[model samples]
Target: MKKEVNIILAGSLGIILGIGLFGLRKFLKKKSQDYDDYYADFHRHFVKQAKDDGNDGIEFLAVQ
Candidate 1:
């Protein structure tokens, strides 16, 4: 009986942890992609303005 209970508890814990990890991975994946899009958009707006204004050209340097 005791061994059966231990097995059940362990199985439940493993399942819960698996679910948590999956959710965390998904959330992080979305955030990572979104951050890139937002970063590009910000740079794009600035570049657009500089491109339109011949005398207001800007230089861009991206460092990882």
Candidate 2:
């Protein structure tokens, strides 16, 4: 009886850990995508602003 209870507890713990890992992976993926989208948007805006500045032959430095 004790062995069966231990097995069941172990299985339950494994399932819980698996679910937590799955949720973390999904959250990280969504956050990464959001960061990528924000970067793309900023890049586009920077390029557009540079183009509008009318300095066609000059390169701009990106300040971090």
The prediction achieving the highest lDDT against the true structure is 2
Candidate of highest TM-score? 2
Off by over 4 Å in 1: 42-64
Lowest lDDT sum, 10 consecutive residues, model 2, at 55-64
lDDT of each: 0.82, 0.83
What tens-digit string does per-residue lDDT give for candidate 2 at 16-44? 99999999999999999999988886577
Query: In model 1, which residue pairs have backbone atoms overlapping below 3 Å?
Result: none
lDDT over C-alpha atoms for residue 29 of model 1: 97
Itemize residue pairs with steric clashes in candidate 2.
none
Task: Give the Å shift of residue 37 in candidate 2.
Answer: 0.9
Q: For candidate 1, write residues 1-64 as lDDT tens digits.
A: 9999999999999999999999999999999999998887667755634345444334432321
TM-score to native of every candidate shown: 0.61, 0.64
